[model samples]
Target chain A: MVLEATLRGIRLVGDRTLRIVERIGATVAFLVMTLVHSATSFRRFDLVIREIFFAGVQSLIIILVSGLFVGMVLGLQGHETLQNYGSEQSVGVLVALSLVRELGPVVAALLFASRAGSAITAEIGLMKATEQLSAMEMMAINPIARVVAPRFWGGVISMPLLAMLFSAMGIIGGFLVAVVLIGVDDGAFWSQMQAAVDFRHDIVNGIIKSLVFGVAVSAIATFEGYEAPPTAEGVSGATTRTVVSSSLAILALDLVLTAFMLKGWN
Target chain B: MERSTLNLWVGVFVLLGFFAFLVLAFKVGNLSAGGNGTTYTLIAHFDNIGQLKERAPVRSAGVLVGRVKSVRFDPVHYNAEVQMAIDTKFPFPKDTSASVLTSGILGEQYIGLDAGGDEKMLKDGDEIKLVQGAVVLERLIGQFLFNKAQDSGADKGAQK
Candidate 1:
């Protein structure tokens, strides 16, 4: 009996693994179909506007506040180190480079994923649960164009805007800390920062990364939502998956983009 | 519904804020270009380029007038060759010395120029002859620890 139970436990685990694979595959297929359909029926200007409003505009506060604090922390840390070496002017360079290249995009993407990803998943899941998606199909309306397109486009546009904001705010935060709190001269800090960063390359690279992140977040959330089963349990599962997948995608893309950008194609 | 609308407004405000910030950064930060000034080009040879990167600033008398453009390792000498661009206005004599200096304790490295008084100024593409290379941090830290160990050893011997 004990032996039989052990075998049963192994079979259950195998079945669970297969189930997860099946769900993931279904989501991928649905995402591809959504993308294709949206591309074919690309006449929806209103959808794009709505997307920009929702995805880009909604998450600005958190990005700014977080960016500000991050800058402050960097300044504080950099000041201590620079003070040790009597090179306090270099604090600006340290803070600026850190914000422009790494912190800005990564932090913004994570924040956006949390805000927009959850909403997209919950909205799609509810639509599926309430048969709204099916009703739209019966009415000869393409749900992908009507629903998914707006969110996707919004995410794509908003991410870059948010990233730019984050980087800017972070610089200001650093400036405040370096000049006011740390007692460094304002002119020196600004000059050091100017010397350190390549504004054109750094800003453009950050925006490009943000756009990619936006796409990943929207695509993952929309996939999870559209594929959610009709039950309440399905909605929760979709929400969880959307968050996890988008966060993972953001981190992975960050690594890839960092490597590519640092490789000096510019 | 209402939450979505709220989100939309917030995003717009953030975008506006970002644009304003960019304008402010460029303005207040003084990231602008002016007429070409006096500058000099210096080449440094190194066995290892280490963490030196392109666009790293070059400073003379605590003023930045140029930057390092590229780093290439010469196969003939098996040494890293660093090319620096200086403003045209800052005159550097032929006898001037160039050294790689760290910004902070663990901060990025830059090329520091010490102005020399030669009768002639270094023209475009002229290389500074006396380069002091980089002061590697690991070696400095190691020396500190070794000296401390030696001092402790002497103290113990005296006590015995």
Candidate 2:
């Protein structure tokens, strides 16, 4: 009896695991289809340029403000902690390394998810809800090529640039707080950061992370929208799913990428 | 909005992104000042590298001239073999001695070069002959205590 019950429980878990694998396979297929359509969409590059403005330009303000405040907080906290050990001069290194390695890309992506990601989902979901997608199909128009591809390409192009801006601004904010405001030696601030932060190791890794996050976030946002039910409630649910799932995806991918990158270091 | 205006904004955004990249590369990270220009490799041997790591800076008389490219253990020699990429701009005499030195107290260790009066200069792939390993703090304290004990012992003998 106990053996039979255990066998049933194992089968239950195996069934659920298979379901998740099936869902992942479907998502990947959808993403590949979107990319295939995006090839033709590239002919009308104006649509992508417009989407870039909407997705990237519109999200710049929040990214810059959050970046500056985060850097200032890092500077204040780092100085307070390092001063105890009489190493306040190294605050710049602390701020730069942490921002470049962890905070800048991850935080910027989280913000982008809420800002542009939700917008894309809502727009696409609303189009589906209003039967606009059906109307496009009736016109023999390819909605994925015309609508989805542009947004996907825009987001992919924008994420790394936004991340770079965040890192650059945060470093400036940190310098202002640590050197100008808190009276740490200015030369030590920049020089120590230069010594500690390697271009290929830290900066390039940060760029790579933002690019990965961009692809994951854009894919999740677009997929959720395209698959949403043609109703107000379903569209709303997909928008929420876009934000939550993409946020989780960004963090999980960051962990995996960080582990792989750090292993390359001695 | 005007089509030209929209195009202008996108162009501006892309330009801003590239500018941000430049600032990050030069200001935040050391892409401009690092071992980027022309650099030649030099090898050194150390008994104990302690906590020295790859990409550590190499300085000659407090001025940075290169970077440590790699660190490996030589099985036959039983010593640490370090490869440094030194800038071609700063050439050192072949007889220069390399010493691993720490900055301040509890700071990161770097390789420091003391130039000799040799006529020849260190070339690419040349191995530095004189190399001093990192100074471990515990070993220094132990040596100091041992010398103090010996001095007190001699004092006690003279009194007796």
Candidate 3:
């Protein structure tokens, strides 16, 4: 009986693994379809523009506040550490490098996933639960094109913008705490930052990172929502999954991208 | 939301995002063209570059006067060749010495120039003859430790 139970448990694990693999395949296929549809659907333009407002403008205040706090903390920490080495003036370099290279994209994406990503998943999941998706399908209107594509595109566009704003605010916040509050030289802060941070290498890579994250997060959110079971519990579960999975994906992708981008610096 | 209201918000959002992009590119990233004046090229060679990257600032007396354009290895001289672009506004003598310097303990490296007393002004394509390579901290620490060990050995011998 014990041997039989062990075989049964192994079978269950294998079956669960196959199901997960199948789900990932389906999600990727749906994402590809949504992308192709959105590429052509821009001619409608109205849907995309409206969705952009929802995705970007709605998230701005949170991004700004979080960015400011993060930057100020960086400044305080950077100043103290650098002062010990008689390099207090290099606070700007430290702040800018940390924000642009890592913190900016990663923090903004986590915030985005928690905020807009969750909302998209919930909205779509509810529509599915309420049979609105099926009703649209009955009318020969493609729900994926009409609903999911615009949101996917909107998210893709908004993520980089949000990250840029975050980094910009963070730099200013670092300046305030380091120079004004902590008494580091203002000239040294800005000058050292300008000297160290390169447009093509640091800033461009940050933008690219955010853009790729936007695609991944949005795709996962929409896929989870679309595939959710037609029930209230299913909708809530899908929303939770969107947040958890997207956050994990963001960090994983960040590591891979950083390895690729900074391959030569050493 | 109405299309017009949506359009307006989106327009504002795009404008803000664009402004942020400009700040990143020009202010933080320093992608802006050198103001009003043109830049001319100068070259220097170093024995080791030590994390010196392209677009690193070329400064003189704590003032940014130029930037490193490119870095290449000179197989013939067995050294690294660094090409720099100096803004025309900040002219220096041909005898100026250039060194790769770090901003802080672990900060990025930049080219620092010390003005020399010379009658001839540095012109386009001129080579800065005096060049100092990057100071690698690990090597310095290693040398310090080796010296300390030797000194301790000598002290022990003297006691014996």
Most accurate candidate by TM-score? 2
Candidate ranking under TM-score, highest first, comes to: 2, 3, 1
- Give the clash count for each candidate: 14, 0, 0
How would you encode candidate 3's per-residue C-alpha lDDT over A1-266 as one tens digit per residue? 99999999999999999997887788789999997777545978788887788888899999999999999999999988988988899899999989998899999999999999999999999999889999999999889999999889989999999999999999999999998998898888887787678787899999999998999999998899988988899989999999998999899999999998988555
Query: What is model 2's DockQ versus the real complex?
Result: 0.75
Residues B91-147 of candidate 3: C-alpha lDDT, one tens digit per residue? 899899999999877767999999999999999999999999999889999999999
lDDT of 1 by residue, A1-266 (tens): 99999999999999999997786687667767767777633585556666666666667778889989998999999999989988898898888777777888888888888888888888889999999999999999888878876677767767877877787888889888989987998888886676556655665676778778877788888888888897899999889888887888889899999988989556
lDDT of 3: 0.90
Task: Estimate every model's Cα lDDT from 0 to 1.
Answer: 0.78, 0.91, 0.90
Where in model 1 is the C-alpha error above 4 Å?
A1-35, A39-42, A72-94, A174-178, A181-184, A260-266, B1-52, B85-108, B112-160
Task: List the candidate numbers ranked by lDDT, top first.
Answer: 2, 3, 1
The CAPRI category of model 3 is medium
User: How far out, in Å, is residue A184 in model 2?
Assistant: 2.7
Q: Write the residue-wise lDDT of candidate 2 on A112-190 in tens digits.
A: 9999999999999999889998899999999999889999999999999899889888988898899999999999999
Supply candidate 1's per-residue lDDT for A77.
Answer: 93
Interface RMSD of 1: 4.1
lDDT of 2 by residue, B59-157 (tens): 998999999999999999999999999999989999999999997777788999999999999999999999999998899999999999999999999
TM-score of chain A for the candidates in order shown: 0.87, 0.92, 0.94
- What's the distance in Å from true for residue B99, model 1? 5.0
